[model samples]
Target: MSAVYSVKEIYIYPIKSLAGISCQQAFAEEMGFENDRRWMLIDAENQFITQREHRILSQFYPQISDGKISITFQEQKHEFSAYEHLDNPVQVNVWDDKSEVVEVNESTSKWFSEQLGFECKLVKIIKPGDRKHESSRLKEIFNVSLADGYPYLMIGSQSLDSLNEKLADKITILRFRPNIVISTEVPHEEDDFTTFKIGDVQFKNVKPCGRCIMVNNDPENGKLKKEPLKTLSKYRVVNNSVLFGTNIVSLNSGIINVGDEIIF
Candidate 1:
């Protein structure tokens, strides 16, 4: 049979809740895309900080090249090595999961603090396997990065197109922050995808992603708008939560490209 859908875009958020990097290709790791959400910001209490709390975070753009990761904010740039060794392992909280993370360094932490105007530290997940999925609904244990939950999120491009048709001001897929964007003619078809393959990697669709206020934030200017969510809630609300996209877990490891065929 001919391919029903094709991969349209791939994204990786090296730092949780920060602007993501769009790539032509990415390696599918057990936890998530390689170098994806491997680094994150934590406050003095070692609690994870996200765009939900600080909308300014959306203004910080990240790029990964060679062995270095660079972030640009307010016309300034900061770069750090992809790998670093730290002497202390600090306990950090990501939602309900607590895991030990290695602090990047005092200088990196200072840079972030200055950028966000708050005391925060940059930390990396030393061992992703140390933080396993805690849901009992799944029969197997899986490793995950600092993502809200699940290792992958796939959304049908047509779904966003459908949602846009209902709103006066349309939005882009970046607002949903999906890792995998599949081009399909049908809207919301991914919600029915239980198991599927892209290239040689297999993935299982787990649950519908519940929308949050963070989706209303303008990725371009870090400004909040009472949109998409307000309109989405009119029709997409379920169990009192606005729903869009679907969370997935990788069943195998491989590389996925932008134009690869999605086999269901």
Candidate 2:
């Protein structure tokens, strides 16, 4: 059959809750995209921190290199070793799951503490298998990353386009933070396909992503406002959850690129 949708964009969140980096192509690894959500910041209580509490965290943009990731905030840049010299395997609570992560370094944690103006530690996954959340849907897909629930999020381009048409001010897909953007003709078309394939990998849409206030966070200004959320509730509310995108789990591993056809 002829393809009905094509990948419009690909993104990876190297650090959970921080800014995401857009890419023309990405590798679908076990937990998530390669280098996606491998690192995250946690509070002194060993609980994961996110923009939900510190809205300004949306301003921290991360760019990953071969051996390091440079985060920029307000024109200032701080660099951290991506996967070198991991120290101290500490257990962290990401939402409800207690996943084990290693400290990137003391200096990196110290810098993040200063930046966020609080005591926090920078931690990274030792490997894709370092953290596993048991699930029966996909036997081989229990390896969850720092992501809230699933390894990937897929949003139909038409969904955002439809949402934008209803609002006075339009927003970018970055607000939704989807890893895969499929160009479809119908809004929320992603919901129609529960199983699909892209390149050598297969994916399943677990459920509609229930959004939170973090969507109000403006990555451009490090500020929060009741938007998209408030408007989304008008029509997207279901069982007390305001959903905008679909949470996805991978069935295999492979490279996906922009403009690639999504075979259903």
Candidate 3:
């Protein structure tokens, strides 16, 4: 399918590793939203647990209110105030192969366990005092992010609807771990959007997003299904990445809205 040249929609997930809220306007930095995905969940060993491995995480919807974060799932919900400064935090590993993280407190840990019915802890990464983004490919681009990988992952709305239509069951769009959601007038046009502008910001396409089991999780219900992933595996495979959305590098930073017009 060919793309139509127009903007349709935009969205952002405030908290990482949980269900996201649709946004009309969001501030964009080089990596993504200023605080989006800035904090994460780590296991006992401080290893990062994500939707890719833990599908149940998709069930929780997270929202930020008055400097606090509230998470809701099933019939249970909880709101916790953000710590101004965590005390006695231990250094932990976010991944087995990459990323070390600083742990939060046990009070934060109990809050998450109550919500998810599991023993887990919450932690925030202290922003690196001295870190730099030296992309071997895009040397001129400034990369400053707390994301597990890459600065931003943008997905087209039509691309998701197209995928869900193929499945016999209705699937929510949250399965794919995207940082930005854009609606383009052209059907399936985001696949070829090399350069596009949202508000005053412009983005350069870096590569096609690679997909994984994360796409199969039901964000609202936290259930694992096999049909969609099975279907996508048959056709969407590209190199090593599953090839769903397009990975983009920021050209200009600005605010993007849900109804904002995208210029291609």
Best by lDDT: 1
The digit string of per-residue lDDT tens for model 1 on 1-264 reads 343799999999999999999989999987889988888999988889988889999999998879899999998899989897477888877777777788888888999999888899999986767577775656766788988888888899989999999989889999989899999888888887888888899988888888899999989898999988988899888889788999898878899999999887
What are the clashing pairs of model 2? none
lDDT of 3 by residue, 45-109 (tens): 55666877777777778787788878777787876765443655555443222333444566767
- Whole-model lDDT per candidate: 0.87, 0.86, 0.65
Give each prediction's root-mean-square deviation over alpha carbons: 1.4, 1.8, 3.5
Of the candidates numbered 1 and 3, which has the greater TM-score value?
1
Model 3 scores a TM of: 0.81
**So what's the TM-score on candidate 1?**
0.96
- What residue runs in model 1 are displaced by over 4 Å at the alpha carbon? 1-3
Tell me how far the alpha carbon of residue 223 in candidate 3 is from the true structure, in angstroms, after superposition.
1.2
Which regions in candidate 2 have their CA more than 4 angstroms from the true location?
A: 1-3, 134-141
lDDT of 1 at 90: 84
Whole-model lDDT, model 3: 0.65
Candidate 2 TM-score versus the reference: 0.94
Candidate 2 C-alpha error for residue 62, in Å: 1.0
Q: After superposition, how far is residue 132 of candidate 1 from its true place, in Å?
A: 1.7
lDDT of 2 by residue, 1-264 (tens): 364788999999998999999999899977999999888898998889888988888888899887789998886789977766466689877766778898888888888998888999888887767777755444544788998878898999889999999989888999989999998888876865788898879988777889999998877787787888989999999889898889888888999999888887
Decide which is better by lDDT, 2 or 3. Answer: 2
Rank candidates by TM-score, best first: 1, 2, 3
By lDDT, the better pick of 1 and 3 is 1
